[model samples]
Target: MAVYKVYAPPAPPTGGAASPEHFVFVRESFSWAAFLIPLPWMLYRRLWIVLAFYCLAAVAMALLAGSELAPVSMALGVLTPFVLGFEGNALRGWSLDRRGYTLEGVAEGRRRDDAEIRFFTRWVGGHAAAPQQPTPGPAARTLPITTLRETPTGIVGLFPTAGTQT
Candidate 1:
């Protein structure tokens, strides 16, 4: 099979409450190879400059905003790309099926709401399904990973969404 897109249905029971639930169709990226293929080209194009600027901005915002607001500043700075990278290029989900695994890429113009983030859940246990061969299209779309942990809702990222306010 060519691995188009693999997704497992969300858990059926919510503590046996028997309420309605939504299936989260997660689409992980292909591989580092996908990025690696363009690594040399990116370096040649001085893409590092963008990364450097992002780091510099993060630090500047953190310092100027103070620890309390620094995280917010840093988040907003990073989120700009998600909001404006592609069209609205926002990665909807991530996958750990392939040998290298992959995360979704931002859409081509789908902007995110500036409202305070309530929460986000990226993956769920025993429910993670492998995408079909070949993967899905470049478009960013997925079902939704609602039950990521034992908890009903949570967000996944470089850092877990625990201990953070909405």
Candidate 2:
């Protein structure tokens, strides 16, 4: 099952709740496309800041590749895709947050649509219920606090009372 983090945009300046259409569901999992083609994936997601950082890293690595640290740069280049695959979704979520999106809740399902349906169903149902106040009741009695007696030196086992050594 896949888990998704649901994000809702900030309310409009007109003073009403944001539309459901604006809600975003970010899947919490490794992205194959992100690993295979990070540039296109970032472009599609509109993750400008992350893309910028990625470009900077790439440039740095490229510079290093031409120097004595070629092996280290090559290693980083190889690992970059795996890092993107794992953290791409998280970066998307961060982008959403930067755009004033608040984390609404988490949903789990086999697919995104299934998760969306399940989340909205529960969300609507919760909103439909009317809240009720608790009625006053008689005060309950409190239990008395008791202190245990200290065991004498060398005494052991579970006895009703502390025992002294023979």
Candidate 3:
């Protein structure tokens, strides 16, 4: 299954919980297309800051290697694009975070559309009311906390432990 990290606008125009319509599912994996064409993909995604950094870094690398080791620079030139493929989605997510896009959730399916359908279908099933945007409201800094843990014996859900209080 293709894994996707779902992102939604900080504030939906309609207000309420963000619906599937407002979600952007970015595949959580390396991209061959990004590896082959970093600049084009960066431009298409409108990652201006990342693109600027990438361009400057590439140029600097070239200049530093100019009078030194040509092969090292060539290797770096070839390697950076491949690295971009691995990190492109991560960079995009970072950009989204900076732009105030909330990460609603992570989902998976065979195809992109399938992932969307599954996410919404489950969403609707879980909620008694109609779908609402996920935004809590302006001026509120919050995230819909989901499962992520370190301990091996940890449980899921809000009340994971039923142990006695001190």
Let me know the TM-score candidate 3 reaches against the reference structure: 0.69
Candidate 1 — which residues are off by over 4 angstroms?
Answer: 1-45, 65-68, 71-75, 87-166
Q: How does each model score on TM-score?
A: 0.21, 0.76, 0.69
> lDDT of each model, Cα atoms only?
0.37, 0.86, 0.79
Worst 10 residues of 1 by lDDT: 111-120
- What is candidate 2's lDDT per residue for 18-64, written digit by digit as tens? 88887899999998989999999999999999999999999999999
lDDT of 3: 0.79
For model 2, the stretches where C-alpha displacement exceeds 4 angstroms are 125-166
Superior candidate under TM-score, 1 versus 3:
3
Q: Write the per-residue lDDT of candidate 1 for residues 1-166, one digit (tens) a residue.
A: 1112332333345543211133222222233322333334324433454445556765787686766776678787666444323311012222222222233221111222211011113223433234347768869578665555644445555556563577
Ranking of predictions according to lDDT: 2, 3, 1
Report RMSD (Å) for each prediction in the order shown: 24.1, 5.8, 13.5
Better of 1 and 2 by TM-score: 2
